[model samples]
Target: MNTFRAARFALRAKPTASFLGRRTYADAAGPSDKIRLSLTMPHQAIFKGTDVVQVNIPAETGDMGVLANHVPSVEQLRPGLVEIIEEAGSTRQYFVSGGFAVVQPNSQLSVNAVEAYTLDEFSIEAARAQLAESQKIASGQGSEADIAEAKIEVEVLESLIAALK
Candidate 1:
């Protein structure tokens, strides 16, 4: 019984380095060569002068975007959408209901969002419904705080729907 340590898949600038992890590799880049990304756990990473992203839930507020060249920002991220444009030009979108993003220019992006889900796995209809519902809540009897939160929800759902395409 071989207990696997990690399964990493990195998309290099070209098509050369693909997947790298474990011993039994099936691609040209499978944990064999030295790839730039060192990721642990799915859809997240620690600050190794690299990028970090995350997602989660709670229906707190809205969505945010954090890029590598983001000017070292600090903000309280409300749940919604997290778009990741890899160095390889590949875009990976996530839905985050609540969390925050810490960014640095040409360096890294650290995202900690509550309840994040990949846009590729997102449901458009569901997102649309959520958007509509949140909009209503935000516009209806929500307090200032509630409205702010609903706005975040709407943004996140809308962003997810857009990214899925």
Candidate 2:
């Protein structure tokens, strides 16, 4: 009976949405009406009741911002900043690197990354270190592959730093 119960529990247990190995959020943020996000780790977020908003992202071409119910599309994100409308009707921003964002017109959104968090979680000290490292690599002109890697890292780090209040 005990073994059977354990098996049942395992089958019914909820999965976790983690970032870079660290558990990001068992349930990162609550659902909303305007936008609903589904993560791979088995979590969902909703941005309901948002009419107009902004989403800043580092795109393959460059940085771009999207508005509410803009359109159904997908983009390869770069390391950079993202902006959104807070529930309080204020601007909310975050740092994202090496991820893709999905958009829908009627009300849909999904952003997946190696790691992601709010601006509140960023630290100044961490940003400085990353900036220094990125600058060093940029000066070297290391290689196309290396430059791309460095650019992505720098972008993500910068995004984190910008979130620092």
- List, residue by residue over 47-79, the lDDT tens digit for candidate 1: 234433322212233333322222234446654
Off by over 4 Å in 1: 1-71, 78-81, 87-89, 104-108, 136-152
Per-residue lDDT of candidate 2, residues 47-136 (tens digit)? 333343345566675665544333356778776666665446787665655678776544455666665566667678878888889867
Candidate 1 has a TM-score of 0.43
Q: After superposition on all CA atoms, what RMSD does each candidate show versus the true structure?
A: 13.3, 15.5
Shift in Å, residue 59, candidate 1: 18
Clashes of 1: 24
Where model 2 places Cα greater than 4 Å from the true spot, the runs are 1-33, 37-54, 62-65, 137-148, 158-165
Give me the overall lDDT of model 1.
Answer: 0.46
- TM-scores of all models? 0.43, 0.53
